[model samples]
Target chain A: MTVTMGKALTAALRDAMREDDTVLMFGEDVGPLGGVFRVTDGLAAEFGEDRCFDTPLAESGIVGLAVGMAMNGFRPVVEMQFDAFAYPAFEQIASHVAKMRNRTRGAVGLPMVIRVPYAGGIGGVEHHSDSSEAYYAHTPGLKVVTPSTVADAYSLLREAIADPDPVVFMEPKKLYWAKDEVSLPVRTEPFGRAVVRVPGSDATLLAYGPAVPVALEAASAAAAEGLSLEVVDLRTLVPFDDATVAASVRKTGRCVVVAEASGFAGVSAEIVARVQERCFHSLAAPVLRVAGWDVPFPPPVLEKYQLPGVDRVLDAVDRLQFDDAPDPRFLAVSP
Target chain B: MTTQAEHRMPAVLPGGVPPADALLPSAEPVRFLDDDGGPAPGDAHGRYERPSTELLRRAYDAMVLGRRFDAQATALTKQGRLAVYPSSRGQEAGEIGAVLALRETDWLFPTYRDTMALIARGIDPVEALTLLRGSWHCGYDPMATRTAPQCTPLATHAPHAVGVAYAARRRGEDTVALVLIGDGGTSEGDFHEALNFAAVFHVPVVFLVQNNGFAISVPVSRQTAAPSLAHKGVGYGVRGERVDGNDPLAMLAVLTDAVESARAGGGPVLVEAHTYRVEPHTNADDDGRYRDHDEVAAWKRRDPIARLEAHLRSAGELTDDDVAAAGAAAEAFAADVRKRLSEEPVGDPAELFAHVFATPTPQLREQAAWLAEELAR
Candidate 1:
C-alpha cells in the first residue's frame, strides 16, 4: 500500500511497541497531541499510556530520563520535538546518553533511540528549521541515521530501535508527507550503508536526509546537459559506508557532498575529508561540498537561499574542476 | 571524646527558650541530638526519634571511615596521585546517612563530592577512585553495585536517578533511588527537571542536597535566593524537608524515612542536609581566597564525628574498644588506599577502545590498532 513517511514512522513505532513490551515512547506533545508533526498520532491511545506518553517540556530531562530508563529494562524512544529543541538536551546527549554505556565498561546497554525532526524546506520559523545532525553525528557512541524515503524511514527506525545502543534517528521534517509504496514489516537496506539512487560516472553527489532528493534532482538535471552524475544516498551519517562511497568515488573520480547544515565542521566536511582519504589517488579533481553557509539560520522567508538545494548542488558540481573529463555538451556548445 | 556538652555551650538554650517555632517546620535545620551527646527534645522537632543504640554505634563507625576516606583522597591529590579530589570531610554525616539508608537493590546516584557515599556503601575505595584517577571511564560497574557513577557534571545525575526509580517502579521492583547533590547544584536546570519529573510521575526517588555552603568558590547565597535549598522542591510539588546535616542520627533518620516512603510509592522527597564543606571544593582550588578561615574553623567546632562520638559515649553505647576498633579500621583503609594509589599507572591502549560501545566499532578498532603501532614505536 502507498504510505507517507509520517504514517510509515507511526506504523514503525506501533510495530516496535507491539513487538517489545519494554519499548517506551515519550516526549513533548507526543501523546495526545501526537507529536508537533503528528508523527506519533494515535500511539498513546492505541498502546497504554505507560507504553506511549507525553513528557514535561524539558528536553534535558527527556534525554536524561531515557538514559536512566535504558539502564533499567526499558528501551526508550524519545522524540526531540524539533531540531533546535534538541539543543537543550545536548549536554545529556553528549555527556551521559552518548557516554553512559561506554563509560560503564559495557555493564549497561542503552537501548535508546532519540528521534530528531531535523532539516529545512518546511517553512519552519527560527529554531524550528535547523539541520542539527552534525552535533549528534560528531559524538561517538551514537549511531546517526537520516532516512529520506518512506520505506527506509519505517525500516531504519525499526533497526535503530532494535539495536542495543543509542541511535539518533534524524527525520527529515519535509519528507514526512512524501508518499511511496511500502509494505508493512518491510525489510530494506540496513543502516550504515549508502546506495546509488541515480547512477552515472562523470561526478558523484553524496548526501543524506533532506539533501538526498536534491542530489537526485541535480543528477537528473545534469543528465539533460550530457553530464553523467551519480547520486549516492548516505542514509546513515556516522559509520558512513566507505565501501559504497569509495567505490562510486573511485569510478567517478570526483565527489560533491550536499548537506543543509552549516558548512564548517559539518557532515559534508567529514564526507569530503573521508572521500579524500579513501579515494585520493582516483580523484580527477578536489572533492567539493554544497552546504548551508556558516551563519545562523536565516529567517524563514530567506531560508531557501541558506538551505542547500538542487541549485547549490549544481553549483558545487560546476566546481568539480574536471577539466580532463569531457565538458557538458551545452557548455561545450556555449563556449 | 569529652562527655561534657561544653562544645556547643554557646548554642545552649538555658532559659528553656524553645526555638521560636518548633512546631512549624522552621527555617532552622532540625536537630534531634545536641552537641553534648544528649537528645534535643524530639517533641518540638519533626517526625524523628533517637535511633537505636546499635544503629547509632554502626553509624559512628561508618562516619569515621568515610571521614578517613576523604582525608586519604585529599592527601592523594596533594601527592599527585589522584587527578583531583573533592573531599566530603565535614559532610560525612549526610554522605554516610544517605548511603546507609538505602536497601541493597535500591540505587544511589552521587556527584563528584560523594566519594564518601560510595565508600560507605561498601564499594571498594580503589574502584570508586577510578574516574578521579583520570581514567576515561567511570571506575566501577554501576549495574553490579546498583549505583550510577559519581557524576562530575553539576546536577546531571539527578534526572538519571529519577529515571531509574521510575523504570524500577514500572518493572514491579520495590526500589527507590537516592540522589546526592550539593547546594550549588540547586541552581542547575537538571536539578529542577529531576525533581519535577519525579513529582509528576510519583516516582520513588529521594533527593539529598548537601548544603555544603559553596560550589567551588561561589557561596550558596550567590547560587539561590529561595528560602532554603529544600524549599526549591516545594515549587515542583515535592515535599521538601531539612535536617541537621552534622547530626548523624538526624541525617540517617530523615533519609531512612524518605527512602522508605518512596519505596512505598509515596512519590519523591527532597531532603536538604544543612551542612558545610570543611575543606576546599577540590584540592586544586584556593578556597582561602573565597572565604574567611574563621568560617571554616566555626564549622569544625561542630564536627560530625566528634559530636556523634560524644553522643554515643554519653549513651554508654560506645566504649574505648569500639573507638579503637573504628580507628584501626580507618587507618587500615587509609593505608591500603595509599599503597594502591602510590603505584604507577599502567597504560593499556586497548582498553581505550574496549568500552566505547558494547562492541568496538570498525572505526575504533582501526584507531586502536593505529595507536598500538604508534606506541610500539
Candidate 2:
C-alpha cells in the first residue's frame, strides 16, 4: 500500500495501542482535535479518551506526566507541539526524564517516547521549525531516532515505544505528507542502524531526518555528472551506528555530513568528528559538512536559503578531491 | 446621578454570576500541642489521639538527632570538610516530624534544607549530604530508601513527586508522595505547574511547603501578594491548608492526614507549614544581613525542641533522665557523622561517567576513555 508519513505514523500508533493496553498518546490538542497536524487523528475516537488525550498547554507538565506514567508501567508516546515549543520542557527532559533511570541506579527504568515534529520546509511561523535532534543526541541517556521513510516510521516508532528507555522520536515535519510504497507489519531495518540508500565508491554523503532525501537527490544528481556517490541515512542520531559510517567513509576515503541544523556544534559536526577520528588515515581530503547557516531559523521565504539543500550538498561533494586517480584500493571488495 | 441597579449592571457577569471569592488563606494554622504546655482549641469528639508518651519520646529523640546533625554538618563546612550545609535547625519539627509520618513505600522528595527529613526517613546522614559534598550527583539509592535525592533546584522535584505518586496509583499500588519545598519554592514556575497538574489529574500527592520566612534573602512579602503560600494552591484547585510548623504534633497530624487521605483517593493537598529558618540559608550565607538578630532570637525562644520538652514535662510524660538520654544519643549520632565524613571519598575518574545511563553510549564510552587516559598521564 502507498501511504504518507502521517498515515504510516498513525498505523504505527494504532498497532501499538491495539497490541498493548499500556501504550497511550497524549499532548496539546492531540485528543478531540487530533493534534494540530492530525497525525494522531482518529486515535482518541478508537482507543477512548484516557488512552489518547489532550493536556494543558504546558510542555513540562506533559513530559513530566509521561515520565511518571512510565514509572508506573505505562508506555506513553507524548508529542511536543513543535520543535522550538518543546523548550519549555527542556529542564524536565534534561534533569528528570533523561536522568531518572540512571539516578535510580537502574532499579527503575522509563519507557517513554517524546514525538517532536521537527525541521524546516513547511512554511511555518516562528518556534515551529527547528532540527532539534542535536539537543537530544548530545544528551547521554536519551535514545534519539528520526525516520526518513514510511516503513521505518512504523517500525522505529514501534521499537522506540517498546524500548526500556526514553527516546526523542523526531518526525521530519516536511516528510509528513510524502507517500511511499510500504505496508505495515513488514520487517524494516532496526532502529539505531544506518542504511546505505545508494551504493557508490566516490564519496559518502551522511545525513539523517529531512536531509536524507536531499542527500539521495544530491547523489542522484551527482551520478548524472559522472561522479559516483554513496548515501548513508543515519536513522538514529544517538547510538550513532558508527561502524556503518566508518565502513562507508573508509571505502570512499572522502566524506560529507549534511543536516538542517547550523554548523556550530551540530549533529553533523559530531558525525564529521567521528569520521575524522576513525578514518583519518584513509582520508583523501578533510571531512566536510553541509549544514544550516549559524543563525536562528528565519521566516519561511528565507528558510530555503538558510537550510542545506541538494545544490549545496552536491557543491560539498564536488569539492572532495578525487586527484589520486584509482584511490589505490578503492575498487577492491573486501573478500 | 446613577441608580444602584444601573451601577451594578456592568459588574454582573454574562450569567449574573457572583464575583469570584477572594483567594484568602485558611485563617488558622492547624495546631495540636500548644507552646504553653496544653492542647489548643478545636477538637470535635476528641477523636484525635493524644500525643502518646512513646510518640512524644520518639519525636523528641528524632528532633534532637536532627538538630545535632545540622550543627555538626555546619561546623564541618567551617572546617572545609563539607563543601556547604543548609541547616534545618529551627524548622526541624516541620521537616523530621512530617517525614516520620510517611511509610517506607511512600516517596519523600525534599529540598536541600530538608536534610533532616531525609535522615528521619531512614537515610544515613552522611549519604543524605553526599550531593551537597560537591563530589557526587546524589548518594543513596532512591528505590531502596524510597526518598528522592535532596533537590538543589527549587521546586523542580515537586513535579517528580506528583508524577511518581500518579505512576504508583496507575499501578494499583497504595502509595502517595509527599514533596517538601520552602516558601521561596512556591515562586518557581515548576511549583505552579506541578500543583496544577497534580490537581487536574487528582494524583495522590501532598505538597509540604515550609514557609521558613526567607528564600535566600527574599521574604514572603517581596515574593508574592498571596495571603499565605498555601493560598497559591487554591488557584490550582488544591486543598490548601496551613499548620503550626513549630508544633511537632500539629505537623505530624497534618502530614499524616494528608498522606493517608491522598492514598485513599482524596486527591492532592498543599500544606503550608508556618516556620522559620533559624540559621543562615547555608554556611556560606549570612542570615544576619537579610534579617534582624532580634527576630532570630524570638524564633529561637519558640524552639521546637524546647517547647516539646516543656510539654512533656508538664504532662508528666517524660522525666529529666529521658530528656538527658535523648541529648546523649544525639551527641553520639553527631560523633558518628563527623567520623564518617572525615574519611576520604574514593575518587575514581571512571565513576564520573558511570551511572550516566544503565549502559553507556559510544560517545560516553569514548569520553570516559579520554578521561581515563588523561588521568593516567
Model 1 chain A worst lDDT window (10 residues): A326-335
Clash pairs, model 2 backbone: none
Which ten contiguous residues of candidate 2 chain A have the minimum total lDDT?
A: A322-331
Task: Show where candidate 1 strays beyond 4 Å.
Answer: A324-335, B1-25, B41-44
DockQ for each model: 0.48, 0.30
- On lDDT, the candidate that comes out on top is 1
Q: Write one digit per residue (lDDT tens) for candidate 1, span B134-181.
A: 877677889989989889889999999988998888878899999999
Best of the candidates, DockQ: 1
Q: Model 1 over residues A215-273: C-alpha lDDT tens digits?
A: 88888889999999998999988667888999999999988998888899998898889
